[model samples]
Target: MNFAIRALRKNEQRVAVLFIMTIYPNKVSASTSPFAFIKDYSGIPREQEILFSTHTVFRVGKIKPTFNYNRLCEVHLTLTDDNDPQLAALTHRMRQELCGSTGWHRLGHLMLKVGEYNQAEELYNELLKKASTDSEKAHIYHQLGCVKDEEGEYKDAALFYEKSLEISRKTLPEDDPSLAAIYTNIGGVYHNVGDYSKALEFYEKARQIKEKALTPNDPSCATSYNNIGSAYYHMLEYIKAVEFYENALEIEEKTLPQNHPLLATSYCNMGSVYKDMGDYLKALEFYEKALKISEKALPPNHPDLATFYGNMGQVYHNISDYPKALEFFKKAHQIKEKALSSNHPSWAAFYNNIGSVYEDMGHYPEALKFYEKALETSEKSLPSNHPELANSYGNIDLATSYGNIGLVYNSMGDYSKALEFYEKGLEITKQASPPNYRGLAASYGNIGLLYRHIGDYSKALEFYDKALKIKEKDLPLDDSDLATSYKDIGSVYHDMGDYIAALEALQNAFQIQQQTLDENDFALSPTYCCFGKIYRGLKDYSRALHYFEKCYTIVQQVLSEKDPALAIIYNNIGDIYRLMGDYETALSFHQKALNIQENVECNPLDCATTYTSYGETYREMKDYSTALIYLQKGLHIREKKLPKHHPDLAVIYHNLAKLYLATQQYNIAMENIQQAMDIAQEKLPLNHQHLLDYRETFEKI
Candidate 1:
């Protein structure tokens, strides 16, 4: 036993290990008597130090709460293998305390406090079955349902909660706190099942009930407030969420002790809302407050501690302090792995979060490695009916990974395969998540982007609208996430030449971002650039240039000069000059954009659109051969970076065909245009304007 303890302290875990069996000095029947005092080590021992002298044995009669361990560990722990009656003494006291039904419930609560969920569940179940009163039954069912919910049997768990509600409704007043709790539990089950509207409905009902029953500022009412807060949080109404969480905290601080778990929960909820609202430092402060109480009140391996760690990790991640995020996430993961099996919903969550940090670092292999592990763990262990299983699948099927792999295939001119995986991921998300779920919105966004890649802006807008409608209802009014959805829709509008719609969307995004983010935030730079492009499309060159300068200044301050996104801003600025017929300025900006990308990306394909812009400029100048050369360079880039049948590839192909004809390669021009026409009609809508143009061009050929 001493050797085992020393090895564990040194962290030298080995397969072969000693086990200790607790023995009682049994004075029972003859056959069981000898067997009880001496037992083999095939057992469970809750603690380690009973092999010392019997003189130190804990006696039953009058005892102190605990002996002082404060004086012990400075000197190395000595293990004596001498026979001792310490285990017998402790066991005798426990048996005396645990002799009745009241005693069982007390011991069971202690087990729950220590996180012995199985023992607690068994004891609670037994007590509930034997319970005599309606109030007791309702309370027992509520707690048992909580244990079931923790086990992720949400529907079955809902039944238990409903049964508790039935009893509470019959025995308790409608506005009783007990009845309000029944409603809250049902709402939580609904929230877990992706029925957020139903969740909101029930949580509101619970709040109203509690508000009527409890006195103003009563801490018991805070449970209802917390319920409402959680529902709003899951619904993505961060501001409203903060309001409710704060209301809960105010009441709690007035009526409950500061160190209570409920107070910590309110603090954590407020912190998460602040974090989502982009107040990282404030989020960190609240998380630390929650952590201080939790560390003192709850066990180190408590599941709530895992949530604290996760929230801390997210706050650090938002601040770009990745090392701090990693440390907290690892601790969260360790505690969760010990407390719950790997397939638990929180376990799946931490794996996805840790994987996202790796994703941000451009470590695609490592990110995918972790995602695959999470998916495998979830799929194998989670019930087929579990919603988290679908979430895991959705994470593994993320569009970014598909887009990356598609680019790889496109580099190999395997456009078909790229499209296949994108379609697969899109289909899975549509089937798995609810209609209003963010996963569904993101899927639509990905499909729209893919359609735009294929030169089907009309089709792109069709999907973008579907995505935007969902995002608008769920995202906060001024949320930064809205920026991307607006930008994507604006780009589709731009391609369709709907300048009014494009300007409205782009300007809305830009205004919201400018309000929410710092002037120098890198994300704001793209928003400015997008607004400039929309203005350029509207033929407002002065306004375009104004926004372009904003973008350029921000980019210069925040991003490296050689960032690939920098090229897009530069080219948009160049386009404004080109449209104004300022050829020298156009060439200057284009050259700077090209120089930056060439140095940083090194892939000619990355600047393919820039080459296309140069070719278009030269064609306007009637320098036909140079235009042909640049357009051909553009085509070679598309061949390297886009699927042969990709709409973007077809656009470049069509441009090259026109340039070829201008250079008098009539037969070659006709051949390329015919292939471009096939790609357009096959991949794009029949009513698509580009499809119409290509068909007309093919007829002329």
Candidate 2:
């Protein structure tokens, strides 16, 4: 066996000599034993042992024929197997002696690798008690820091790493590998604590040291790149994150094996960057590559495989492939449920992901069930005010649970219940340390949506602006969340008859969506619809049809045929046709919308809106009897289902008045016009074009 002493500093040699002295105090004299090698190397006055040869060289220069403690030296000890009882006995004794220090260090490292953090801490702490020098104590402290890091005690881990770093700076050279490693460890602690700026500071320091001291493709240098990428990723700097991730991947591919776990991590990190950038196809490509490597490198039940499956799930969900998303999510959940403890935060995260998929699919009951499960798991696993429960980027897990429940209630047309849950989420988000702006934005947006549905445009705009302000500050320019805020604000403007502001906000959202999202992404559908409606309000029929067609094409590609969203686009297209004097084409499109509504279990409000559009198309064609029938059908449903002051009801009544006027039923026409005028006066702005038009129609009736 040959033991090579490599990368040892000048002071390290003195420490090693002291350690040898402590282990073999009286046995330092020349003898035919392994301990004899230490005596020859230490420059003590002793004769050479006949059984062994020694090689020692001073690093700086040849020393005088005298003991000089200042000179740095390299020592090589070689033991060869021989058919001799004395040699065997000496080898056995050497193993037993070295086991006290080296064995404990190796065992502690193994414990840390296996996630036995408490055991690793105990072993490292025991080693600290026996550590005789600053170098030895630094190594022990570094190991203890690793144990704390693994246990998620980031503050304590950082303290231990700083202590190790302080000692290393004093005892080791400026560009020592140990100093680089300690800097990286401290950076990891800051990264885990959500301090991306602080994390980047330390990570840059580590990278500078590693670049100076290590080769370009060294694994340690790659780790610094990877850590820097992670910090950028958490900061939502996707382009910078991708750049650093590619750098790490370049080094990893050059040095690591094809199936190395580190290569999978590099690919996974790239996938996350693309995912956040709203590039679903690129995200999926990287995620699949990571999954392939993880499957090859890890066991079927490994947590890394679960992560890959979850990442794939997120990609599918983003692209609106509900079935595929559910399939991947369920696979990930199954693996995580079996691999992790029931109350583990990872299990909660998995459940939350599954719930989000269900929510996007409009399966509200299932969404609520999974969201509740996530909350239950979080309650068991996390402390009451755990920071992880409050996400800084916007969606706090605990607040998300409440907000998601509110969304389901809103979808179910239960406005009061939705308000209760949304406010609950809002209050929780406001209590977060530094306040979870992202969560606050989402809660405010939800409240805005509820208010919009209830026809309170002023309150809706207020909340929507609140969401927009937070999102503008927290999100990047092309972020999907920023697009959503703009979309909500635009929709409120449209409802308030502020067509110019609506067009401006919708165009802003469209520009962002075009930059960041796929053409067929479901999130872009609403932006398209809003553009269509704004153009239609401006009487730009050609532009209205163009946007409505875009919305229709996207929904056709992404949604099922029976989706109620299809009916909305159809109705908008019908309205455009009516405005262009193509009444036959208008009625055909409205009937197509009505057919879908009648066939599917659609929302009654949607069915009523389609009926009103159909009535308007028939009245345009001078089909008074048919127009009255459709108008009455729509009015009956709206009167029963909608609030008396709903703007939609006002529009329906206006259509009924026009139908009655076409038939020369002057008294009934005047009565219906009066109702329309009353609702318009109550709900619309004084100078609104709809109110002016309604007043003219009332005088004619």
Candidate 3:
């Protein structure tokens, strides 16, 4: 006999319970009472039992058992009574069945959904012991993998996922949904660990199966598309990421409800892609769309809402709108604080975002405070050597925290302290299994910058070379990061006065930037400026002016009118005109630069550089009195701001000696020449060209 129990709603307030029982002859007789089993099993009172029948195949057993035993005897019972006790008993039985083996699987899944990772792991492990078939074991293992993944134990999660895949391959048919699911899980682990290439590989594997097995516009397929888009986004393949995100959105728009969370996710992913591509308006449009959907479909304090706010904060930060960025960042932090624990990684991310906003606003102390909070959260939540804490793959949040703190120190002019934190980050990166080349390069670059600022040109060049070598090995030829490496090496070479090497390195960087960057990209401005400086050093005034003009045009388009960066371009142009013997034109440009420096709260060193350039141009034009005035102003500022023995001070003294000699102030010229020689001897190498020039000038005096 077969029995089927179905619940059907007959009206607004009544649920009609239908029981279809098929009985064979000799197996059970109708006169023996089908209702007897229910009475005995459930122990319900006979008066409470209300049953209505639609079909009757059995009489009181006297109607001749004409049907053979093989023939089916079907009985249908419908209970529409609102207060029937038998209905409650049947509902209890159904609930018990649901809480059995099949129910345990659902319970474990619920544990995972609620972030009870340890509990889910325990439940799934216990279920594994009771699994009878390989398919059942595979499902349990897959759930275990999910638990580990949520706990941020990526390596263990990957191993468990692979084990599940192994079992699935052995027991399931080719192209099974189980296989696709395991493949997707494995891809997620790789994605979390910063292996984008491997992530794409596994994602593609899952995608192929899903495309073949599932109908078009399946939500599961949309998930696969979203994963692929995320992998591409992290890889910095922004256009390709957009393609996949659009594919996911197309499926979602067709199959999902207007306010579905998955549709919101698709919108958020699209926003991120536009953000990375520097299309801030488009990014905000998508983010707002996602926010609208989330507000309608999610709780007020949902963590996904926090993500939307943080992303908008990042967009405002990039645009240099500090107050707006802070507003959004704080919004994100508030939501995350309410929804997540202090030690949650999401909380850490929120802290980091807030820190970034403060850093951009030049609030170093506030930035450090929030960055420290992020570090504390990460330390509390993640293991010391966990991939999320530190990994050579350059994706660890801890490494970023260390690097950001170093930047704050550097900006405060604490070079030694900056180096300390930068080296700490580098050490963590070095300890990662594969030694994250990208992280190593970043640390090296930071250390190089500190050395450069302290005037240790050789040490700066050495660190820059280390960074460049790693970038060359790890990045593609046309990658913007690789261009940055070449540009750094070129700038270091320029600082060291190796103009030939500087030209070659800068050219390499320019070519790569031309290939990879947009025509109007601000990143190209520095490279153009460097070219101008190199050409000026080589005495190619026309070529130098050409590059300087290019830099000026770009800077004017990207930055504000009073920006100090534009002052640098004007100063460079002035130097070029002075060298070309166009003294009046040179003075005009120099005056423009000087006016900007005087009007703005400029760096003292930068203001001094303009004064020195003006003095030199006056001396070339034979205006001794005016030259002396500008020279004295430059010397006074340099004396106050620079170390006493700085090579730059020696240059100023040398220039003063030449001016005095030209004016036939023989005694003062000799005195100034000797002072220049002494400072040069102390600060410059014996074989340095500047030292040789000082010696020649001293002999002439």
The alpha-carbon deviation from the true structure for residue 370 of candidate 2, after best TM-score superposition, in angstroms, is 3.3
The global Cα lDDT (0 to 1) of model 1 is: 0.69
Q: 382-447 in candidate 1: lDDT tens per residue?
A: 455545423433343343344344433333444466567556556655555445357667767766
Candidate 2's TM-score: 0.70
Per-candidate alpha-carbon RMSD to the true structure:
11.7, 17.3, 17.4
The list of candidate 2 runs beyond 4 A from truth reads 1-175, 179-182, 346-350, 375-395, 434-436, 471-481, 510-526, 552-571, 583-644, 653-679, 692-701
Sort by TM-score, best first: what order? Answer: 2, 3, 1
- With a 3 Å backbone cut-off (N, CA, C), the pairs that clash in candidate 2 are 394-438, 394-439
Residue 169, candidate 1: Cα error in Å is 4.1
Comparing 1 with 3 on lDDT, the higher-scoring candidate is 3
**Which 10 consecutive residues of model 2 have the lowest summed lDDT?**
57-66
Regions of model 3 farther than 4 Å from truth = 1-174, 178-186, 216-219, 233-302, 308-328, 346-378, 381-395, 408-413, 562-567, 570-701
Identify the candidate with maximal TM-score.
2
**Residue 36 of model 1: what lDDT?**
23
